[model samples]
Target: MRPVYAISGGVSKFAKSRPDKNYQALVKEAYDYAIKDLEISFPAFTEIVDGSVASYFSDHFSRQLMAAIMAQDYLGLCPKPSHRVEGGGATGGLCFQEAWKSIASGHMEVAAAYGFETMSHVETWKGNEFIALASDVSFDYPVGGFYSGYYAMMVTRHMKEYGTTVEDMAHVSVKNHINAFHNPYAQKRNRYTIQDVRDAPMVAWPLTRLDICVMSDGAAATILASEEGIEKLEKAGAKIPRPLVKVTGIGRGTDAMRMADRPHVDFETFIKDYATDQEKESQETMKYYQKLWDQGTRYPGVHSFRAGRTAGNMAYRHAGIHDPLDELDFVELHDAYTSSEIQTYEDLGLCRYGEGGPFAASGKAFLPGIDYGLKLPDKPVCPVNPSGGLIACGHPVGATGLMQAVFAIWQLQGSIEKHFNDDTLQVKDAQKGAIHSHAGTGTYVTVSILEKE
Candidate 1:
């Protein structure tokens, strides 16, 4: 909300595993990188907000509640106000929001938002159990409902209703993996094919191993400054950074905790009834589900679609963007799964409802050079997940949202030339971009618009 808040610098280190580095080490690394990148001294920041999760999984790790304080100590930022913020997967974005508020409220002149996670220390199933805690314990846990099941249900319903196919989902994986090839910080760099995705072992029916993002270890940091802080630095003979990206807009939303609480039609029953009676019962069934779909779009998310939609709308309004497909140059979506990315296309108003599958298959979401189809627009409608996204870029829970912000800042500042091609997916003189992030089951969602200034 702060008009004067601008991102001066950012850094990220995302990888499949960082066994040698603990949470504190990762945070220190990211903070050091951000300061070096901005060529600014540590004293420039008056406050710090650390976004992190599950650091106390083992006794060897930092205490659960002391991660932020520990990070501050590691970075030699003592005697300064440093607070920790967590919103499940949306932790980093929320941290950025709080830091922005601090600067805007005149509490701090310069602030830093940093996030990290070290999941490699635990086993895969153990990590899944920990993450599952984010969901409603009474309803979700009783029925063995985790993220995979939630997404599978949504994808299954989408398929039955909208005719989204397996190939369509596979295309999403292919596109993002190709994008990951260009990202040095990405965890999964292997180039993949549609067949490769299809052949991968199934995690949930209709969703395969390739469809899901891997648990990762990573950290990301961003430096923010108010107008006064910038002037102070300049007056102090410091080199003012050029082409900073301002936080133009931000939106947040939440929904019912239980998936069943949200409106949804019995897709299987609807299909069966339609086959049995095409005239009377089938028509009523279709209408009923249509109503459900309408409601779902407004409050969608057994997987957080509602939060994204609400947040995106607020952001679009604040940013004065009437048409997302035409106005925004790039998007960093919460692509914890390939299905989520496709679903986001519709939620973000990039395309008509139920057209997400075809949109991905059209190759318009990928860079210009990668050939999923030659019929793709010379430039994509909006380049989604250019930094490889959560799928290949690594989803380190707390760090993911900030990583997305870092990508947007670098892309807007024209500092990411080595990673991506200048001629391919790059929007010419790009001015604006949006970052979307969500917590468990869409309990929390945040969207932010960044503008080149």
Candidate 2:
């Protein structure tokens, strides 16, 4: 396989509504940003491109099909081979990896991956109803399994099993919103307090409005190129940024769409058969799993995401990451809600399975030097959601995951300040980072490792 590098990326402003432009123009806006960052003309940069991959969540939202074809024509990539990818919320992440695969498989030297979602076309409730269709129509959707209720149910189980408190979840909200305060592209940039979070209108018992990510209208694009492709672009007057972000590893996992259809393996079998080195490292960690078993806690009952764990495990192995909390500089995961961020910490091996709550409350996953106003016990270990994640940055489904890639590229390129016009959120001396995208009660999850090269 050939090596792949993400040379540049762009994002449109994330907001509840973008009536000024259609989806095609929104995509072009982001694509233009990426090309402009390379100090190259639009036609000049396109001259080196081999093909492209398009990403979007639902035709129901846009009320248009063949969207990718329209985008291809709009971007002037006519007749070049291109396809669209959709996997619930992981659409953009899947698109990114697909573009990488095109290069890695020697099919294309350079590929463009772009994703967008204009959810504001429908009423808020109508949009949610459309999103709920991602679940099993036979069981989950029929029973009114709205996404928030499903997440609320899962987090409640997490609270019951792992002693994860609403306060723990609130800490996550505060941290992410605070981080978004420094991000210019984020949709919700309010620096909220724990009280402010807790006081917000309740959606589901423990999850308030602040704890949930808002649906957004946005687009994101990234350029992936091989060594030859980079040289070709450079020859065409594209000033690619220094410290290129290389795609070292990529992994994905999927599970049953229906929650009840999921199988529950015993904890002992889980640890012995499938656990990774970091997951089963110490006797203390063994005891923790054992205690959960002793209390009749089974593996991956609605409380946890087995798919997320599998994705992280595969990506870490490919990236040669044995100790994620130590080796990686930061992580950008699908934080559809604050609780999921904590749950993902455990999934990604940043913390143990049950410690996700404490991990958030400890401030270990927080960005340091930025006063979150909440008195945190632990210093920063591995900052999660430094771009405010989906909760603060906004969840445009297709654009959400690619937004992560764009931010990761900028972070590794040390251009966060140049992009956001703010240096406060950049991880200091960042060398490697992970971007995780999750979909529908962990039905689909994608994890990729990006590093400076």
Against the true structure, whose lDDT is highest? 2
Q: In candidate 1, where is summed lDDT lowest over 10 consecutive residues? A: 51-60
TM-score to native of every candidate shown: 0.86, 0.99
Residue 14, model 2: Cα distance from true site in angstroms: 0.7
Candidate 1, pairs of clashing residues: none
Q: TM-score of predicted model 1?
A: 0.86
Model 2 agreement with the true structure over 1-453: per-residue lDDT tens digits: 999999999999999999999999999999999999989888887777899999999999889998888999999999999999999999999999999999999999989999999999999999999999999888878878898999999999999999999999999999999999999899998988999999999999889999999999999999999999999999999898887889999989898998898878887788975576876788888888888889988878898888898998889898889999999999999999998988898888888888899889998989989999988999998899999999999998989889999999999999999999999999999999999999999999999999998
lDDT of 1 by residue, 6-118 (tens): 55544456776887788878877777777666555655533332221221122222336666677777777775677778788778778877777777777777777788888
**Candidate 2: residue 117 lDDT (0-100):** 96
Misplaced by over 4 Å in model 2 are none
lDDT of residue 59 for candidate 2:
95
- Whole-model lDDT values for every prediction: 0.72, 0.92
Q: Identify the runs in model 1 with alpha carbons over 4 angstroms from their true place.
A: 43-63, 236-238, 264-304, 371-379, 418-426
